[model samples]
Target: MGYAGRHVAALLQSLGVACSGTVRNVAVAPEVIRDAEAVLCTVPPDEDGDPVLRLLMKQLRDSASLRWVGYLSSTAVYADREGGWVDEQSDADAVDETARRRLLAERQWRALARDKGIASSVFRLPGLYGRGRNALVQLAEGRARHVVKPGLVFNRLHVEDLATAVVAAMRRAEPEALYLPCDDEAAAPQAVLAYAAALGGFEMPPAVAWDDPSLSPALRRFYAGCKRIDSRGTREALQWAPRFATYREGLQDAFRG
Candidate 1:
């Protein structure tokens, strides 16, 4: 299982709900799909398209007990809003190859559910961090960086909040539903790193320019995006709210842990 899938599965198991999942590069047992009441696909698409659907579409279609399907997608599906707000109804204008692939995978999953008369929900996730996977860990490992870019902001969600929203969505099982699970605040990357440093009593790392030559291509692409994800509709529909409503609370929790 990947990061989000593992947390979701753990949450389900803790609630005494039976769950099964496939690990990356591992062959999945047919019964994993055949006997489930619900299925959540967290796999990302490759150049060839959705690997899960390629291998398991037949099993998913044939499953007698499956009633609901969920797909984890990226907020990158929405075009960069130039620091404006984007909601669930925002048009998907995927600008990058990775995001385009994700959008395609979302369509494939929704089509499958529609064909089978099963409810399907898609969660559009922003940057995710929690516990061991947070800025504190980065600071401790000496890999933390403070990237300075004025008017640039990014949305994030704590993994625990993600798990909670996913369970809530499963309970609702709304047909063709879409969700944006994000914290209340859209913050600058450097601000988050600075806050983490203060929380963990570590010295703040030197700020790097957004155009720093040392930044990886992927990191540069991340900085190119500027949007505030609006999750009000998701909250109203799911009756859910993030426990860590801002990066401050999320980093605080990670610091304490």
Candidate 2:
């Protein structure tokens, strides 16, 4: 949702369209924003259905003149594959707390949009990195570990790429469509950490087995599964491509800063 708002807001402002955003605290103020030419919802769904979603839907439905509703979701909602690949067409088999919660949230928002009669699309994003957000800095600071979770690989994207995807979707958002936003490469966690370590002029972090008792059971389970997402829908539909294709290039860019 943050990705949607930060970019879409600028996009709106660039076009001279009056815009207003809502959070859990400010959703009730839609009346103040009712005059907005477009309403791009960046609100995320809770583990349960978002209460504000119903309210937002009601407002969007009741508003006399409103256009555009976008829902932000996670690619983590995709089923864990134990190192298999998934696409927008794949089923969701959430394997951990975060993924399970996100899957539930995606379902709730889709249901709300259907019942409320709103034009909405969901963007499923991969691991996000940009600016100061890349893992290189963390690994450089000795906070990141290249865990040898060999079976798992994940697609990643820069925030700028994610931003452009949202803009592209808005340029052609339909009533109900699911979009997967990702870049070309999928790397194991250890691989990304190793790259980050190299950027910091250090050796890779020690390998830690998932069953190591030193690691919390919950965290171990979180790291137990791997996911590789397909981004063909995003590439074909949006006619988009990523600037940072791999961690090595991306980290070098990050390090240069």
Candidate 3:
């Protein structure tokens, strides 16, 4: 299990819900799926496409007990809105091959659930952070960066919020539903890092221009996007709200944890 899956499992188990997970090989996945009343797919699509649909589609299709399915997708499917807000209704404009694959996988999962007469939901998530995998950890390990770009903003979601939102969706599953689960604020990456450093008593890194030559290709690409994710509709539909409404609270929670 990856970071998000692990947290989700932990949250579910804490609530006394029976939960199980598989690693990369998914050796026990079919059995788990067959027995599960609800399934949440966190695996991402590869170059060949959705590994779950490719490998476990038959098992899912045949599972008699399954009533609901959830797929974790990325908000990157939305086009860069130049710091404008995007919601669940926004048209998808995947900017990269990876995002395109995710979009395709979302469709595949929705289609399968629809065909099976089951409820399915696709959660389009933004940057995710939590204990052991946050800016605090990055700063502690000397990996934090402060890249400056005017009017450039990004959204992040606390892992706990994500877990709770998923649980809420599971309770009220809807057919082919789409959701944007994120924090209330869309802030610059530098601001988040600075807050993390201050909260953790770590020295903040000097700001680097967005176009700095030292930035890696991946980092540059991350900065290429400028969008604010709006999850108000998601909150209304799921009857759930983020406990950490902004990076400030999220980082503080991570620090306390």
After superposing candidate 1, which stretches have Cα over 4 Å from the reference? Answer: none
Ranking by TM-score: 1, 3, 2
Top lDDT model: 1
lDDT of 2 by residue, 158-210 (tens): 77677677777777756677888777788887887777776677777678876
Query: Quick one: how many clashes does candidate 3 have?
Result: 0
Q: Record all residue pairs in model 2 with backbone atoms less than 3 Å apart, i.e. clashing.
A: 79-93
User: What is the Cα-based lDDT of residue 215 in candidate 3?
Assistant: 99
Q: Estimate each model's TM-score.
A: 0.96, 0.83, 0.96
Q: Per-residue alpha-carbon lDDT of model 1 for 18-44, expressed as tens digits?
A: 887877543565767889989998888
Query: In candidate 2, what residue range of length 10 has the lowest lDDT sum?
Result: 36-45
**Candidate lDDT values, in order:** 0.89, 0.69, 0.88
Q: RMSD in angstroms, all models?
A: 1.2, 2.9, 1.2
Candidate 3 lDDT by residue in tens digits, 65-180: 99999999998788788878899888898668878898889988998998999999999999999888899999898888888998898889999999999999999989999999
